[model samples]
Target: SLKGEARAGVQFVKAQMGAVSPATLLGLGVGAEGDMAERHAHHHHHHEDEDHDHDHDHDDFETFQVDLPALQDADLFLERVKQVIIDHDILRLKGFAQVGSKPMRLVIQAVGPRVDSYFDRPLADLEKGKTKLVVIGQAGLDERAIKAALQS
Candidate 1:
């Protein structure tokens, strides 16, 4: 059920990427819940008025790496990636995509149970495209499901 929600959310994000606006600046920061708040405060440098304690719990993370096939559709692969991010307690993801004339670099960060929109940038400067990707999360990441999705 959670995976379904994540898939839906990612689909919305994908559509927004094209409909919203051209890619400009993209940044991703990750840590515990406490770390997230601290980082945000640090960047703003003016959240000193509110006294919040940074005693949040840290989550465990696992990692997965797979090379996509030559014919793998970038859009389809991304769809599956959303499933994995949702099904598993995935906290972070970084990868690349080369879809026809559209080339992009992706950085994904998930906080708690939330899968944030990945920042995408045009890779016009690169002479070649890369397909390999690494997914970081907890133990629930299913290698078989991911492989099956990519192969499908």
Candidate 2:
């Protein structure tokens, strides 16, 4: 069922991409017994015995948004964020921040500890000088500690 769902999602994306198959677009093609297929099968089988309750389906991961004060120092702010990512095993992080006195908004993107940032555009009237980020990681993240570290 997982594989079927994955195929359906891929097909939908393929249709959105002007009928181009995802594998062709990405230059990837795998046979039925391919390594990727094997891995997917193994993963599916490994979780076959787990409960499939819809209410608790998202127990594997957690997502939360953090809004904090404007960051004064870019370097310090990035360091703190990196520490949080490492400590929490964050899978992905993305958001915008207002660096002190900077006329533009800082766009932050991170994937598994590799953080990147740049000034995207001039801050809007209402969004100026604000730090807002969405953090995603496996379940059991220390929300209080993460908030405290980023706020400081």
TM-score of each: 0.42, 0.65
Candidate 2 lDDT (Cα, 0 to 1): 0.78
Model 2 Cα lDDT, one tens digit per residue, 1-152: 54574412134342554677768777575554466543432234445556543334356789999998788998888988888888777888999989998889999998877789999899988778789999998799988888887888
lDDT of 1 at 8: 32
Clashes in candidate 2: how many?
Answer: 0
TM-score of 1: 0.42
In candidate 1, position 15 carries an lDDT of 48
* Candidate 2 colliding pairs: none
Give me the runs in candidate 1 sitting further than 4 Å from their true place.
Answer: 1-59, 70-73, 101-129
Highest TM-score against the true fold, candidate? 2
Best by lDDT: 2
Alpha-carbon lDDT of model 1: 0.53
